[model samples]
Target: MTAVLNAKTVNYYPANAGWTNMWTAFDPVRINTDLAKAAALGADTVRVIVFPQTFGYPTPSATYTARLAQFIGLADTNGLDVKLTLFDWWSNYTDIDNSVIWALSVLHPYVDDPRVITVELKNEISPGDATAMAWARQLIPAIRATLPAMPLTLTVDGTSGAPGLTSLKSQLATTPPDYYDFHFYGPSERSLAEIRRAQAAVAPAPLVIGETGLSTVSTSEGEQGAYLARVYRAAQVAGIGSVAPWTFNDFAAGAIPANSSVSTQPAQYKYGLHRTDGTAKFAATVVNGAWTSATTPNSILNLGFEAPTANSPWRQYLPQAGAAAITTDLPRTGLQSARFTGTTRTGSGLPSLLTSPITPVQAGQSWHAEAFARGAAATGITELALSWFDINGAWISQHTSNRLPTGTTTWTLLTVDAVAPAGAAGVQLHLKSGDNTGTVWFDDVALT
Candidate 1:
């Protein structure tokens, strides 16, 4: 068996530049520094991406080609292998000749280079697109013809998962590459099962989890590390050939290209293991733990939400345009409080929120949860809920507390005391708002 390849996707855009400015603003110092960091984490390989349009397409410019070579050379200096992903931001599938010429131009220099461990033909190929599949099938053999010794592969995007790989395998069964790259972004608990399904999709051929990560935009830094710990352990147990996290560093605000859909979401920018300031996140420490066979420190669930890592993750649902946020207006004890504002509820439920999710529990064990909340111009009723979830992270049912004060109240106590129902493995301290116009502030939440 090949040694388990541990890699980090280093296709990160620095603070002010996006993919469009890659070559024009190529910073070798930044890239080299990041590569050294990855090596320090004990990763044997580092993945990089190349956008077709960014480099002059079918005909590459001398400067662009030189910059790419420089990147690989720097990786070699750091004693790390490279997985170069091509056709990053390209989609014109009609011109197969153009694709082949461009791929040939890109692979010519790295044909027999030892540092280039694998060449991923495309970033993520859509199985449903007939034109794209046709484009990929023809391009695979042409690349194999020139770079016979090199291992060639392609990744099915995380959105598609196993089903996408199954579809692609059915379409390109005859002319497949040496292996496959499966981008898995499913829940941590489902990692093993999902990987098994993906492996079965492309049986005889090997598979690697090319990308998996949880962004801190919606989760806490501690939870992000927990996610990596679980998934990487699952990968090791499943005996997959390789595994790599999605991003090495988070993108700064407005760093992603404005034209892409990712630019619209706030969560997309914070996926990196390193913050834009060059400091590492909790996930980076988890990477070190996994690579070195050391036990990762447990994630401290700071129910008070006051610690540096703030272990709880609070999310809003059925939100207004800008309904919910963490603010410093009136914190019960700490520097921050969660605010949820809404008009009237249109759906069956109120504009509610779920937070401090998934603490393990026994079947019939008694539990208590409490949070201090204040209402401003509040109406209707406020209820605290203990939402139960099964072992697979599936919601079962929720037990609501008796109604709290309805009208505007100062820092009132909301509580839920209940026994875990049968088949309950975990629970979330849920905060459900009123159905009518009002605003709520929550702080000092605890579940025990």
Candidate 2:
């Protein structure tokens, strides 16, 4: 049989070069140039920041909205999607103050725009503080009631305190946005695992890695880019919907005060894909490479990890291997299911499977299963058998079919039911490969 494409849309973040100038002064040429570049770079979405101070925060003036609309118009004209970042009160953004209502006033128009997919309320709200949450609550409702179109979101910094997985649940619960915006730095696989586990706490809600980079800003640009690619690809296999690196352009000398003391040299600008003079660094290349990847280093999909406690399991995937890492664990104990992985770990060779096993499901009881499978060397097909076993070890019935997609090193998610089964002690998910050499890696087995 032919290989299934398993092709998904990619969300890209390029440099919004003119965004800084928008704060105090709006430059048409600078803004247009940046937008044009983003469009040319194959980006489906561009994140735009609206600093409150420069745009007259807390006082809805027509001028601020007009200036923003001009940029939105440009984006629409270029056929690029927008992920409008609102109320960026970072250090340079201090003048914007913290008035979500004012943010709403200036941002509501774009939220209704067809080009926008989501509204990023705040950059990184201080952990344990409800500032971003408060803002989201006030804004989403107003926008939903007035001009509801795309989803509303707030990006969280570092899982709300290494407070671990459930740390941000409070914010999400208090004011539910459409997706969970999370960030990560460093190269620890354990931390990435924790981030994946924490995703369960906000089950059902989509998760996006808004920022990622080397923890230490002093690292060489080449090392930063390579590490960034590794982590970003890991994130993709681990089932993150989108991953946007910190910034696209290089940081200007002394442009940021906090880090100014860290590096005095001109080329030492930290956490950028490119240098100030538009020198594309190694990190930029890594991001570009990972953005288009469908597989990882280990290339095996093990579907035997913990299940997602979140309401939505389809939106998230458990941790797989890094772009260069590998694993072979499966979901063999809990949830009574098994997952199989293929060996062709790359963007081109992903293997897929389908299964049929009848199981009794109960109403109001949520049960979910997730798989991380790699693709085969070439295109092929497979059917899986999902069956229920009685205490006597006999097959009772079939649950799902046997037609799976095909790809290599790609981490794809297959979800059945979020509600638990009725009168069934255990369930099994078995895969039948289409060919002898078709290998797919699997991990992050979840059944809840």
Candidate 3:
């Protein structure tokens, strides 16, 4: 077999009980919610873990198998492929045969499933574990014999840098995998260069960065977003097979035991793209932006309001002297849409516009903003606005169009086009509503 992965991926690290409590009592609701969050982040693939002890070791339990199947089904429903890692955090070096039996028993069910992108033998097995390596050497062949077309991978800890990759290659010479999986948690440039070298050294075998992320300990939330954007861009340039960040949500306090191996690392707890309460961090925007840019190469971030969360970059402006509120309801497409409702005010706050962050634009270039909107008892005009900014963050000018007259209660596509100024550095899109005492709903807002 050949190595395979969805174009975009992220590690499905839970913000709740995490790996320690995952199998103690299976919670399908939590798993489904996490997968949905991942999907909302524009991830098409997720790296999941399945512990040996939880699966009944030598002979996998039927209950465990059923749950695993269901979990994969959930992921599939969210349009995600699974890179299932087996025997996570287990180091029973002497149980080599049992490990082989475990691999065979667990893998046979997913042998023909396309959703199972790859089956990892273990999670970050240490080079010092000669017994574990021996077990893997034997188990790989056994698994390959049974499922000849399955994509296989071995995740090696890359903390030691290039030397670690060399050591991993030497240790796994007996049964080389189709893909070389490694983890990196360093500067984007350094990680990029290291991945380039690793790819050269492990030619013919694709490389996947299984885990990489920045913690809020030393880096600010904004810096985390910038770092992820840089790393994602670098990975795209280097042609890496996939880049799965450390986690999806930050673990809550007391979620992990104080004595656990990962407890000492406070940074690990803050690595999630979302907080424990489901609020998104700035890193979510950067990741979503990078994924959208890489896959669609044209779509703007959060255009459809599909990622309905408070931390989104879309801003809702309320009238200074009148009542106004923004919400997600009655979407034109996807789960949610931006709805603005209130009494119209006069003066500077008469018409309010929901604006987007400054998006890079080129001078003399033409761009378009489109949205579907509906109005109920609205006596004011609803329109889309585009604003230009210079390189020094100075506002250049603005343009508005796609006006929907009052009393338009049906979904209507509103579009406007603008040419960037001579010194334009970026452009901002907005959903604007004229001073009216009614409700206006917007959805599927897109810019290109």
Candidate 4:
């Protein structure tokens, strides 16, 4: 009724688990503990996803169904209501008839459930895909007719922005769901603007920022807080009815399936307001700070490459197939720098070192990268760069900074500013030298 003041996405996955395996490997103890964490974060409602592969599609399995029920029960225990996100990581739009069967089969038990607050027909529906739209068209009214008392909504993926919501609202004009969900992965400085745009796209109907959060991939924990505060604060200022952040806890290393589309993405593991150890990040301090007093960002992670022994979050591209080591040979500001030797391979196979990923970047956001470097007769194309990735974790483009000074030079402060191209969700500071000979020394790299 009132503005949906406190909500969070329990993008729940335990250590070394993800959508592909979380359901089968569901742990009530882990979830019970985690949902309590959510409540402690000041969320009165939580959003969670159900994947078909693990949830038993077409006919929902008793095992995973009970698992889902237990999850809701745990939310209730935590004094929180639930918003169920359906068909996550599912793309089967061919069977409309069975889609109805699957939808009813899974939602039937929750028809009168008090803990269940909302239903998202599909997570990030593809507006451009006719088949998917047809599925939603039939499922939306079918579910609504059966569960008239409940609120129903679906969303366009962030890559589409507000225009995607406009397109979906146009296509599903006749049988639209109760409200619209908007997943935001945009410039935090423009968060309110983006929310306003989505509200305009889905006007006359209520709008919710279903998912928004900053990843610690590209920035420090403090930056993540500052960035995320901007989102929540803007949502409040924009009078958004509800706001569910992307996650509760960060994924542990190697937690995701290697075959998943997001495995290569470093940002995937770091969206959580809490760490895998159940410790809160600086972002946690301000997740609800937009509506409270704890708005100041506190960072404990080393953003600059100035950690003691050259390994905080910095890692080589492919260690088995790459080259790297800590070197005091050249210290910019700290006691060490990361030394990377160029590889014989070139192009996509080019070897280099990369900082952990930074995320939630939208088109035109300025990302500045700087590093001090000196080369040992470095041959070939040795350089520093800002690599960009789309919302789907696909590598979109890269902007190379000035090449590191070649042929035995002093540590030169190499810097460049990059504009995030259209649809970029993440960025990383990269130090590479494709087809390079000898070695390059780098230290004090920073990206923001």
The most accurate candidate by lDDT is: 1
Candidate 1 residue lDDT tens string, 1-448: 1532444434444555556655568899988888898889877787777888888877988888999899889889998888888898789999999999999998899887888888888888888999999998999999989998877788777889888999988888878877888887877644665777788999988888888888888777877776676667667767774668767788887678788887898988787888888899877877877776644333334455555634444456567522456678888997977777664564556666664433335579798888888888877657788877775678889888766576788998888889988877556666777564677787887776
lDDT of each: 0.75, 0.49, 0.72, 0.73
TM values, all candidates: 0.71, 0.55, 0.64, 0.66
What is the C-alpha lDDT profile of model 3 across 244-336, one tens digit per residue?
Answer: 777888888766656577877888788889888988887887788777665312222466666535334454455463432435567777777
Residue pairs with backbone atoms closer than 3 Å in model 1 (clashes): none
TM-score: model 3 vs. ground truth: 0.64
lDDT of 2 at 33: 65
Runs in model 4 lying further than 4 Å from the true structure: 1-10, 291-448
- Candidate that beats the other on TM-score, 2 or 3, i.e. the better one: 3
**Model 2 lDDT per residue over 1-448, tens place:** 0000111112222233333444445666765665665555444566777776667746856776787777678777776667777666543333233454676577666654667666766676654654544545566666666556557666656545235325555655755777766666633222344445546766677666666665225544434544554555556546665666666665554444343343465433456665566666655545555545533322112234332211111111111211212232422244423333332323422233322112222223454554544454524544333445442344566444334576554555554553323443334554434342444444454434
- Between candidates 2 and 4, the one scoring higher on TM-score is 4
RMSD of each: 6.3, 15.3, 11.7, 7.7
What overall lDDT, based on C-alpha atoms, would model 1 receive against the true structure? 0.75
Candidate 4 residue pairs that clash: 4-241, 16-255, 217-357, 217-358, 218-357, 218-358
- Predicted candidate 4 versus true structure: per-residue lDDT over 185-300, tens digit per residue: 87664566577778899998888888787788776676566567666656666777466667777888767777787888888888887888888876676665543442422221
